[model samples]
Structures are given as structure tokens and as C-alpha cells.
Target: MSDVQVRGARLEDEAAIREIADQEMAAQEALDPRFGFRPDASGRYSVYLRERIRDLDSVVFVAEVGGAVVGVAIGTIRKQESLFELRRFGYISDLMVKPAARRLGVGRALYDRLLTWFRGLGVRVARMHVAARSDEARAFWKSVGAEPWLTESWVDVPAADGPPDPAGSEAKPAPKRAAGGYAGDLPDDDPSPAGMADASDDDTDTDDDTDTDAGDEATAGEPTSTRGADE
Candidate 1:
């Protein structure tokens, strides 16, 4: 095992984190065309990380080996609907470890730090989204005691034409649902460039330790890109 040190993220770490995030995003996009980056994603992600580092309800952690950061994890507190049994839950937004650092415990160290912070905030259950097609991701989460809480479905919505089919004059057929799962869930801040409607993620968490898969698997051999639900 490699000697890994985990600590809270500082402002100076934004560039490194963004670089890893970019690589992860590109890799996941390759897995599923639906995953994409926004205009100036680097700058935008840097800004987003900076804000997360300072936010009281959010936490960012970094894992270092030989004095260089090789892994990162991000999480935030979320309020559930009043009707839910748990009033608030912990949402992992991003988790990543460099490819070279896989299996060295770097990702797990970073994750443990985030969990510590979440527990400090009184969060009882931690939740996240994983890429649907990544067998690696699913296996990793299973090793860590996280089961599939739900499956998210996706579909394409075609543009409407001619005033809703003239109020029932030959009603149009329903749009076809898109096949396959998401590349992964996107970070809240990493939306497509302006003028593009946000593609809402069916899953809720993001992680990328394996690079393409998100969720707990990112902590082992993978790194979730975007929110790939690994966060």
C-alpha cells in the first residue's frame, strides 16, 4: 500500500483538482456520448471547487502521496422532503483518484475524510449515483456495503410542433426513451454551455476513481468523472 495522507482541500489545490476532473470527464464522455463538459469547464470547475472548499455545508478532501495531490473527494449536505424518514442526507458530489494512484488507498482515504465531515454535520446516511453500465463501479460499491438504491432511466424529448397537434387533430406519437444509462451524473455546477438545456441526471451521486464509472467504485480502481454520481 502507498503512503497516503488525507486532508481538507485548500484553494491552491483547485488547479490540480480541475485537471483530474477534466480527464475524468473526457473519459466518461467516451463511455457515453451524453456526458459532456461546459464551455470553459476548467475555469468553471475551478471556481466551483473554490466555493465548495469554503462552503460550510460542503467539504472537499485531498489525498497526497510524496507531497503531490493524487486524489480528491467532494460532498455536500442535502435536505430531504419532509415526508421522508430521514430529514437530511449526505450527498457525494465528486470523488476522483489519478489512474496511477489506483488501489493505493488514496481514494478511500479521501472518501473517509468526507464521511467524517458528513457525520460531524449529523448526516446518518450517505448516498450517491453510479454509472449504469460500469460493472467495475457496481462491484466496488458492493464491496463497501452500498447497494443499488434505485435505477434511473433516461429519454429524449423531441421539440413540439404546430400548437400541440391542433388540440388532438392527429396526436403525435410519444418520444422514444433513450437506450442505456448515463455516462454518470453531472456535478451541479458543470452544466452544458449557455443556450443548452441542462440534462438532468437520473442518478443522485457522483464518483470517478475508475475514470469512467462514478460512485464508490471510484474509490478503488475507478474515478468518477463529473458527478458521475461518484461524488
Candidate 2:
């Protein structure tokens, strides 16, 4: 391999970085089915990198060999708020090196440059998330003195009977509709006369009747209110 140079990324390096990212993503997904590496059909990854390059808190670095980029690292400085303290930390969002560049110290060079940038920003704590099945990534992190603190898990739910919705698993309960057809618990001033009457009657009945009657009414109206809020 030619001399490897690691430095901050620039706009002209966009294409090279994107290609390396795609290559690494494909290789990771091949290694672990749970990676769920979706191809960037819309060029969103490049756009994201471009945006990050211009962000004050973000740092992007690339490693070049023989005048060609072979590795990349993207990171950011984040303000972390906790019960006991507020502090700034560095987050490694991505780190990738070409297959031919592995075991050649390219990844280490990129990480060291990123760490330097973080230190310049006065950040002491750095963190990154690695896939459980990615042994290579875990080993690299450990080599850099990083320790795991959390584990993440995912579940894939199939569509019941129609086309798959990308957000199906995150579907929320529908909001309840008010008597006035309003979706939320909005102010009563805008309610229709009939809705107001119904609300008033319900309130009065709840105050005067058995608790069972109030519970039943609440159960009957719950769905409508939920659906309304969702809308």
C-alpha cells in the first residue's frame, strides 16, 4: 500500500466517501443479516454527509492512499444532559475502510484524527454503537479503549394482508374524537352546540350516577377520541 494520509474531509471527497460507505454497508449486511443495510437509492447518504460537513459540531475525516480516498470516519460533538450533570461528548457515527485497506492501520489513523478533533473541542467522553454481530467492529472499538454500555434489539413485523408499510411497526393508537368532531382535547369554545350538550350531559351524569355508568361511557368514547387525536 502507498503512504496513507488521514485528514479532514472536504466537498471534493464526497463521491469517494459515498462509495466507501456503500461498500462497507454491503459487506456488513453480508456478514450479519440483522444489519438491515438498505441501499441509498435516493442519494440521501451523500446529502447527509454534505450537511454534516457544514455543521459546526460535526467532524468528518478521510484516509487517502496514493491520492485516492480509502477510508472515512464521521463524528459529532453532542451535549448530553443527565440527572447529575450536563456535559459534551464525542459520538462516532460512522467509520469505514475499504476491504483492501483493512489491517493496514487506516481505521486507526482515522480514529486518532477524530479523537484529536474531539480533544480540541474539550470533549472527554466518546461513544459509538456497534452491531452485536459485528465482531470486527467490536474488536476495533476495544482496541481504541471503548467499552460497551448498552445493547439494542430489533423485531421485524410482517404486514397483515397488504403491501408492507415502512412505518407499520411504529403505528400509534388513533386519537379519540371529541363530540364536536375535534381530534384533540382542544378548548370547548369551538365545540358544536350538540357536542357541548352531550359533553355537559356526560359530565352531569358522571357526577350524579353510579361509577359504573361513567366507566361505560368512557370505554365507549375512548376509541373515537384516540382516532381523532391521531388524525
Candidate 3:
């Protein structure tokens, strides 16, 4: 990560950003279709994310090695009356590091940049989503202090072949479990309002309620033509 700079993406960065995204997407598709990029929504997705970046309310951070874009993290501030009610929130929508950049802490650096930016913006909660079955992702998030709290179900369907999942028993929120879905709330930060939010990340380590892969979607604004995977 030496010489790597973390900075806010610019409209002029579209090509480089897209290149990183495309590279990340290729890796994702190869790793899991649920986490891959949408080939069809290429034009629109780029435009949408760039718009978010331009708005300032949203943030997009990246790590570059000697000028080669290696990683990116994207998210925004959102307000809603949902369970995790808050006057404001910093929502992470996407995060990725190029294959060559893995294990270099590029992901962590980008995460911190986005996190510090969010904290400065009054974002009280940090969240991301991962496949229930993706052990590596699970481990990664856990290692970073993100713990799992929900068992996602697609269709909300009737009892099928799977065992009747132990009813509401699991919905119980973690008491000592911090708010990042795992760790406790940030020091001096409001805990109740933050606790109510079940924020989660997509392939980007972002918000909780959006369309992810695995039939079970994460939470966030709909970015059409965008293919993504999260729990």
C-alpha cells in the first residue's frame, strides 16, 4: 500500500473508476455470480454511481498503486423511518479491491477512508452484507468486527423442504453485540437509534436493504441494471 493514495473520486475519474469496477466485476463473476457485475447495465450503473459521487452526499473512495486504481468503496447518507431510525446515516454501497491488491490492506485503507468520511458527515452507523454461505466474507467481516444478526430468506415462502427455521428466536438483537451488526455502538454515539438499524453491506460492504445475489437482497436505493451479491 506504499505510495497508495486515498481520495474522493472525481467525474473525470469515470474511466479509471469503471476500469477498477470492471476488473472487480470480472473477479466477482468468477468468484460468485451473486457478487458479479451486470454487463447490460454498464452505461447506467456508471452514470448512477458517478452522480452519487458528484452529489457530495455520497462518497466514493479508491486506492491506487503507482497510479493503477486498485480498490474502490462507495456509499451515501440516507434518512428514513425504518426500524434503524436515524436523522442521518452513512450507507456503504460498494467496496472492492483488485485481485493483485488483495491482502495488501488496500481494502482496509479504503474502508477507513470511507468510514472517517462518513463519521465526519454525521453518519452514525457502519454496515455491510455478506453471503450467509460465504465463509471467507463472513470471516473477513467478523475479523473487522461485523457480526451476523439475521438469517435472510428469499420469497418469504411457505414451509418447503428446508426445516422450519427456528421461528422468531433468532431475531433477538445482540445486547453486547456491537452495532456494526456486531460490535457495540461507537463511543458517545447514540446506541438505540443505531441499534434499530440492521445495516448490512453488499459486495461493497454497504447498506442492508438492497438487491444482492442469492435471491435474498440487501438494502439500499435501486441501481438498475447493476448486478450485485450480498446476503
Scored by lDDT, the top model is 1
Local accuracy by lDDT, each model = 0.54, 0.48, 0.47
Question: In terms of lDDT, which candidate is stronger, 1 or 3?
Answer: 1
Off by over 4 Å in 2: 39-42, 82-86, 156-231
TM-score of each: 0.72, 0.65, 0.62
Q: Is candidate 2 or candidate 3 better by TM-score?
A: 2
Candidates ranked by TM-score = 1, 2, 3
Error of 2 at 150 (Å): 1.3
Cα lDDT tens digits for candidate 2, 91-175 = 5556666666666666666666777787787866655445444445544554444544433446666666756677768567878
Per-residue error (Å), model 2, residue 212: 53
**Tens-place lDDT digits, model 3, residues 1-231:** 256678877777778766655554444345445443445544644776567678867777766778877666676665644455444555545566554555666655665576678767666565444443333344334444554444444454455565665673544554664334322222233211111111112222322322222211122211110112222
Q: Per-residue lDDT tens digits of candidate 1, residues 1-231?
A: 568898888998888877777766665566567655555776776777788789988778877889988767777666654555766666666666665666666655665676677767777666666555544444445444455554556776556652454456665686653332123233344432211110011112222221221243222122344322122
lDDT over C-alpha atoms for residue 56 of model 2: 90
TM-score of candidate 1 against the unseen true structure: 0.72
User: Which numbered prediction scores highest in TM-score against the true structure?
Assistant: 1
